[model samples]
Target: MKFYGIVVFLAFAAFAQGVPHNGRTKRSISDNLETLVESIQALASEVNEDLGIPAFDPFTDDSVAISINQTLAKLEGELTDLNIDGLSDFSIDTLKFTLIGLKFTFAFTWPNITFSTGYSIDGTVASILPIYGDGKASGEITNLAVSGTVAISVKNSYLYLKSMSSAVSLDDLDIQLSGLLNNDDASALIAAVISDTVPQILVDFQDVISDTVNTAVTEYVDDYLGSMTLAELLALIGS
Candidate 1:
């Protein structure tokens, strides 16, 4: 769990996976799941606010729009001269999305037991080349996916991720849960276990996108300008 306050990606389950906690104690499986997921979402919002270079503000903050637009325009120009092949043409329209922050939007569809969430770079333009960058440093990555499913035990709270490509069955779950009982940090660990079990693709997308979005925010925010050119530094140094 990357806990830097906000702008993060997290997915988990709340069940005991088969462990038997006859009576309730600190929290139920549902309680634990809610906490873990909520905390992660809170972290994303926090990071975005802390580090994200504000995009054009629809909310009365015109200064925000000007600053980021100038910043992204310069960055887009820099990358264009870099001769980086496969990059689309640099334009304010394109850079506008770069200037905009990818929102931490999430929704849970209970009936299917599928946790579906995605980051969208919201802007006035159509979606394309949605890289998380600021006016400073920018990077890109691919293959982002996110997904998780649940299996409830006969007892209600005992839960697990059905790793099977098809729907996970009851027998497969019981065998796994028996040993997990009496374990430490069992609730969190159990959630991670199911989370980790998520296929590489899903995990990769979730993680890569989170990083990409954060990197872009950091790049734009001027906080992580550790890589500014020596000449750029020297100019500041002589001052």
Candidate 2:
């Protein structure tokens, strides 16, 4: 759920002037943006290492807990001592930029994102299914897309992100929670229900997710932008 790749892209765009440039013909802004995108696509691992961002091919987090209660489905569960991995294994399908004056909008799609987590769930899955055990949960989201628009303004002769908005969507989701029930049949049934319901749950919480992403992205991007003057940013881009 962390758009760490996007953050890296923006960081590069803002500070690419530091990158050594070869003597070549002056390129248009669109061409420069394209180059930046290519650089990210080609050197994401190296760039992430340089920036101290952990590689996501299989990022691991040990401190995760979740409590789930769905009244309509008569399901209640709590997953504790969760360990999650593979949060960063995603491939970018497309990255498009639209620039108009000081406003920039980025539309991007991650075609494949997969993760696995191990936890202990203690609760009932359905009214009759007893979901109590240690288990592993895996999921994959396809064609996950996000579009964000950021408006930049100059304040006291420094660039800052003035306002931001974002949208999120996905093509499909598949989830499998296993080893939670004694009966294999019951476990499969619960996993099927989860796979069917998760997309809807995400839809219901789309606004919340967008808000969280917007706030986080704005704060992170602004910190870097604020430190540089408009002239400095322009010089970096031109370089």
Candidate 3:
């Protein structure tokens, strides 16, 4: 999910800055931000390909790790050797950006997103259910919304992401885990419990997600912007 957000953010950022390419019209700096965003959205595919931004539809990760802590379910464990897929097929219901000083707030909603993963978890569910196995997990989230504030800083005329804070919420979620337990009923029950609890868990651990996004985005954006000279950047935007 974080990776998906990062790609989308960078794609818009690149388009807004008017990264130059062959046969593309240069955008004037005097154009309003709203107009620029509209153009970006319309030309998203073209710009993403031209700028070499990672595709947002159908994103995948070969390996990931997540810690599970659910007091209500009495679940405490870790998911390792996890492979995640299907982050790209989403509809952007809304995307708004507000800029003030060196800070900007970005709000967006993905109407629907479906994903699947393979994982191995060692945990205890419902206090009595021992969950230790390798399995496949699949789910869909409805109305996933995110709002974030980003602070930018300049050093040696290069822009860097100084900090970021974000909040995430979803209207609904459904998940299923298979091959975790020998009994089908038990596995289905566990899956139901997870589906119900995950939304709240995301809210509880939002800070961790924000910190991770900040670190990763800052490094990537800083490196990318630093590679270009101020003059080159300005030129791209027709300044």
Model 1, 1-239: lDDT tens per residue? Answer: 11111122112111111223336455443443344444333333222343332221111111212112322221111111111111111111110001012111222321111111111122221233232322221122222222222121111322222111111111111001211223334534543554444344333444443444444433332322233342332232221
Give per-residue CA lDDT, model 2, range 1-239, as digits (tens).
23443555445553553444557766655455555655544444444545454433344456455444453233334444333333333444434434455666677677777777776656654356565766777778777777777788888898888888888887787887767665656777878877777667668777766676677777777777787787776566553
lDDT for model 3, please.
Answer: 0.61
The TM-score that candidate 3 achieves is 0.66
lDDT agreement with native, every candidate = 0.25, 0.61, 0.61
Clash number for candidate 2: 1
Ten contiguous residues minimizing lDDT sum, candidate 3: 72-81
Q: Show the lowest summed lDDT stretch of 10 residues, model 2.
A: 72-81
Model 1 is weakest, by summed lDDT over 10 consecutive residues, at 90-99
lDDT of 3 by residue, 1-239 (tens): 35645564655465446634434566435343335445544543343655555544355566665555544333333444343343433444434433344565666676777777776667675477677766778888887887777766667877666777778888888998886765567778888987898788778867766666566666766666665555564465445
